[model samples]
Target: MPVRSPLYLLERFDPGVVQLDRELRVIAMNSLARRLLPVEDKQPFEKMVLSFHPERSVAKVKFLLDQAECPVSNPPPMTMIINIPERVLLIKVSKLSDLRGDTTGYTLIFYDITELVSGELPVQPMTPESLSIEKPAPAKRQLHKIPTVSQNRIVLVDVETVTYIRSEGHYTWVSTAQGSSFCNLNISDLAERLDGASFLRIHRSYLANLDFAEQILRDEGRVSLKLRGETTPLPVARTSVSRLLEQLGIGEVDAQRT
Candidate 1:
């Protein structure tokens, strides 16, 4: 079978494309990619692909590229959704090969979906009936499984398995005994969707599951929490300490006289 050209596949969608050599250096990119990526001022064509992305995102991009390589012909493209500043991008990576079926390079294509996922689209205004004080507020539904991404696929993590969630800009890192995976939803959104009784906001950046609470470490007025399986302690805000203790059914033991 003949090798399929990256340009041939790129013709189907109006997406940003960045072509890379086997060494992972940028070989070429479409005009759309140059405009969307943060490489306008620098000579980025010959630089490594990882250099163009944020430090936090380098691992994810590397994972995407690694997953794209396959010995089989016409392998499925690896896909991932990532957030950057005000924009969200849906990225896909496919490996390029030579006529002898040897790996030659890679092609990364991305489409912007910020408006679709970030609530930037216009919404309908509430009517008087919808805002009536007579009506009680609807109960927030608890999330059973958090939507997370691993490799090139989306994984649904059971709520009970989650130990904590850390906010990263508009996205989050969902951590469990298995490991941490990227979540597209922000911490605030997860807080609203999770069971209020089980999940507690310990700090601006951390939401911890009370079920996994092992110890509360206090040092010099600063408070942090240790989970059953996790080694590192999660920082607890000064304001949230009292509420955290109360939620754990300990009830401000520090305030009690010895």
Candidate 2:
């Protein structure tokens, strides 16, 4: 009987080993790999990897591996995410080669990263606008110098004087310390005009001035804001809570409350 090579033994021992050909097709997969992927006994491997959404980390790995000066002999491991219906995988890719100074392919090892992606881990808060998932509110005029309003003439008001702004149909109503004014603008448009640090979108219909905000209150995923000069409290959505807390420099407060 012939003795097995150490490399072959190592491949068999690995819990998450996936072998791919030069064409990025899956040539072989280990037991763990089979469990991780949704593959049938007769299905092609390359098709499985390509079915995944183009991920940034994976693209970077491909780029590095394709480089002419790639140090495949001692290729550094790479981390990436692979999205599957049930969960997202956090994968590490390592290069594998033959003994005769010839490149073979890659070995992929990965596990679930659903918790990390879901903000279960400590992560920086990001606005919906930043994600490009939702349109931001329209910008209200800044309140630097008070605007001169005539009895019949319309005037633009400073956004800083406003305690909060609400969306109503085709126009947004800006509420200030003095009074409220109606303007023909959408919330998304308004959000772009105001400074991100000064204004915060708490709810789909509301944007509050953080400088004028007194404090934030949370109850079972619900958030409410207390403005410095306003008697009424503002409601915040659960999705906006983290961003609001981070904007107010009160992330610690939210963490403690949670």
Candidate 3:
């Protein structure tokens, strides 16, 4: 059999096909794709797709976007299976580049996997209830203050004063320039409950405030970060290094990477 035209495949292909612009704005979607996904041209893909699922999916797409290469000659595409309410979609995103190997936009192709494997997967709509197994959380929750039980009393602390959070086994300690406070919540609990952009999970056991971050120091096969007005350094993971360095200033440097 002869190979089909790219134009023909795009128009007549069975799988849901979509073309996204550089800004992740939906430019076009084929008939099958439109029927599967509730999307329209010029609509923001992140905002639209995020509506179906946000909490867990945002980080996934972000990783894909970050791993996305510049040109056709670049690295492999980022692909993942996203389970949304009612359907499971295999989303594959890659760089759409010009002839000169310059990235112009992105092409996202989605395949509905639900039909392939019936009742085994959760087909229920990814509702706020279903999404929040721990607690009934919406797709997005705006957080202004952290509520914690202290001295047998509920204490509401402003979000800005928080410098970092340290988890000691079951308990999570929220630190500030003023001092540290004990919260019944765990570090992972705080990671999900609070504003994610404001707090960076520098390591498994620690979350650092971007506002309070002063510098990242690497020494003797170990990596640590410093916050404003703080003496001791916090642990930094290898995977978290690039993002931290890209965002915050680098202070002291030693020999090796952790």
Best by TM-score: 1
Q: Residue 183, candidate 3: how far off, in angstroms? A: 0.8
C-alpha TM-scores of all predictions = 0.53, 0.41, 0.43
Which parts of model 2 have CA positions greater than 4 angstroms off?
Answer: 1-152, 252-258
Q: Please give the clash total of every predicted structure, in order.
A: 0, 19, 1
Worst 10 residues of 2 by lDDT: 145-154
**Runs in model 1 lying further than 4 Å from the true structure:** 1-14, 122-147, 150-240, 243-258
For candidate 1, lDDT tens digit of each residue in 175-213?
999999998667876787778899999999999999999
Judged by lDDT, which candidate is best?
Answer: 1
- State, as a TM-score between 0 and 1, how close model 1 is to the true structure: 0.53
* Candidates by TM-score, descending order: 1, 3, 2
lDDT of 2 by residue, 86-143 (tens): 3334455666667885667766665543333232332222323322423463323332
Model 3 lDDT per residue over 1-258, tens place: 665532333344356666766666666777665555544432445444334334545655655565676333665666655444444455667788778777777777766533232322222222334333365433423335554445433354667888998987655777888788765445765676567667888899999888887766667767888899899999999888876766554423422232
Cα lDDT for residue 105, candidate 3: 70
Provide the overall lDDT of each model, using Cα atoms, as 2-decimal numbers.
Answer: 0.76, 0.58, 0.61
